[model samples]
Target: MKTPNPARRSERSRRAILSAAFDLVAEAGYAKLTVEAIAARAGVGKQTIYRWWPSKGAVFVDAVLSLSEDDTGGLSLPDTGDLRADLSGVLRAIVDEYNDPRLDAMSRALTAESLADPTLNSEITARILGPLLEVTKDRLRSAQRAGQVAADADLSVAVELLYGPIYHRWMLRTHPLTHEYADTVVEFALRALEPAH
Candidate 1:
């Protein structure tokens, strides 16, 4: 029998740990998630998790990322030249993902846990929210280069405009998030971002 490659075995262990973390959070919530529990579920030693991550929050963020992987390997904002359509596509996808029972449960649990714990919040911001905002910033910068966005437009504000409404609606549960709403948000945001004559 061929000897197992160390790299492949490590990768398998890592994916297993991520899967276990996602499943645990989806079932028991992040508040109850512990390194020991993740190790037990992943069938690895606690030291293995500690060797790979400094904290459970890091593992949680990694799990969240792994769970959200797509054809491109992970979720990323699109840059299709049509700013409105690209933003709409991302927001619509977010809505669809949030509608999944397991994803919804884990996402909400993470939000709550982050709110209650500053360290977890920092980890999540660095790993999850930071990358997402960067993708939006990159897309806006591309649009600006193409003369599709105003030169003076604040990219940070633009990012907020694109994602804030969807997040607000999702968090408050005040209304259903639909593809139509995503498109509407894009139209409204693009109107504000359009270059002046």
Candidate 2:
């Protein structure tokens, strides 16, 4: 019998691990998640998991990212050439995710875990939020080219303006996160980024 190659892991197994990690968090919350459980659920050895990920947080973050990224492992936002509509659509989807019971619990748990682990926080930012922000900035750059945004506008700041309010509302739970609320945030952000008249 030939030993399986350690350098080239089966993609199916990798996906199974990610799916198991996600389902475990959704079912039992992140506090109860463990690499052993993920390995068992994935039908792989704990050593396999350890070799692939440094921590359960890393596995879980990758799981979350797997859901958002495309087959090519890239993320993007819609660009209808209408900045307002595109941004509104994106914000509304974010509100919907925050409102989901399973995703809400998972997201909150990840946030709590990140607070205590700076490394995990950085990973979340770099792996998850960073790509999302960059893609959003790309969309904003397109809007700028279309004369929908100020040419001199700082796009990084523009992306934050688009996303920050919804993030604040979700974190604080001060108001119901709804599509209408998303549209309102988009409106305010667009006003702030309006091309210099």
Give the best candidate by lDDT: 1
lDDT of 2 at 5: 83
Q: Once superposed on the true structure, which residue ranges of model 1 sit more than 4 Å away at CA?
A: 68-73
TM-score, every prediction: 0.93, 0.88
lDDT of each: 0.86, 0.85
Judging by TM-score against the true structure, name the best candidate.
1
Residue 79 in model 1: lDDT: 80
In candidate 2 the C-alpha lDDT for residue 84 amounts to 83
TM match of model 1 to true structure: 0.93
lDDT of 2 at 62: 88
TM-score of 2: 0.88
* Position 20, candidate 2: lDDT: 100
